[model samples]
Target: MMNGHFDTDNPDKVIHKGEYENSFDNMREIALAPNTHKFVLNFWTEDLKIELERIRTLDITDNLTKIKYVCNVRPYYYFQFSDPDGNIIEVTGKYTPKEGQFV
Candidate 1:
């Protein structure tokens, strides 16, 4: 939800908080911005391969990392793509625990 105060000078214009009316900040400059921050989250599961296979059937342009077997450290995956905008939508499943090796 977008909320703002009415511009004091223009009675009808909505100005964002901390912004003044008639300021250069009101200009529209659209462009794909470079990602300067990193945000990564993981979902752990014993059936990593099952989950990966299930994800594959969905309508997704990106992919879930590995789909063979959950047999390593950190079987659940995450991936940050190297595209200009650094596509992080390519959800990756990394290495999970090996047999008898609990991680």
Candidate 2:
């Protein structure tokens, strides 16, 4: 994962890597910083609603979480929440690629 890079030529390709920089607590602090907390994670599913519902049932608290469904520029759904150490996690539905867009 450390040696991997996202293909700039393909917007639909997703990258996966393990958390290796800091401990969960410190990562939480970094994630909370303005302009640094945003990390888009894509999940593939045939039924996005069902996947969303399953994520909603987890033991996540609302105080440190935000969820929304957006359809303006493109149609998609996502939820952001802080992990046990306060690091924000964004779980988003599959990607709908558009020409000239990086997403």
Candidate 3:
């Protein structure tokens, strides 16, 4: 699919939309090269607990061993897991910081 960037994940009826399209919608898409290496992907959300619980409910999901915070400089809550092929996927939530602490 990488040669012409074919739509392997999408349904047959739908094709990719570029910036010039009028009926465009915001949706997540992945660009991958045909290689043996795995990848890491991160996303942000308003609630970390909700997303964490959602992942927990999936019987086949695996929890990652990474830290609970995105960085040592700030308190960005996050969680990570691996796909079946071992590509890492992360989801994080941002909290308001006050007095160098987050709620």
Candidate 4:
């Protein structure tokens, strides 16, 4: 789980807290136009090769999608997918041993 608040006027914010069973931050963020729920997805994988494989085999509809797995890099492996509209979404995940490890 990752949660935080941003400057209402700013276009970005920081990651304050993240928790998972493993040492990874498997979080997904979606961005879209105002007054709309349709958006795009930003995602990262532990291994691009492995993540790609999982992506190919998973069923990611608008309602049944979640973080597939952890990404491979420090910031994490990145991929962008879109909704019906042209909104932008970002998904990222990482593995840390404890609370202060991911940073």
Clashes per candidate (backbone, < 3 Å)? 11, 0, 0, 14
Question: How much is the lDDT of residue 15 in candidate 4?
Answer: 26
lDDT of 2 by residue, 7-76 (tens): 2233365332322234222334544557544453444566544555666687564532233443333556
**Worst ten in a row by lDDT for model 1:** 23-32
**lDDT per residue (tens digit) for residues 12-39 in model 3:** 5344221221111112233443443224
Q: For model 2, what is the C-alpha lDDT against the true structure?
A: 0.44
> Model 1 residue 73 lDDT?
27
Per-residue CA lDDT of model 4 for 1-103, tens digit only, reads 2221121223243322323322122222212223332323456556544453465466452422233333222234233334445344544545333434422
Candidate 3 clashing pairs, residues 3+ apart or interchain: none
Q: How many Å off is the CA of 22 in candidate 4?
A: 34
Best by TM-score: 3
Residue 49 C-alpha lDDT in model 1: 49
Candidate 4 stretches with Cα past 4 Å from truth are 1-32, 37-44, 62-77, 82-89, 92-103
Kindly indicate the candidate among 1 and 3 with the higher TM-score: 3
Global CA lDDT computed for model 4: 0.35
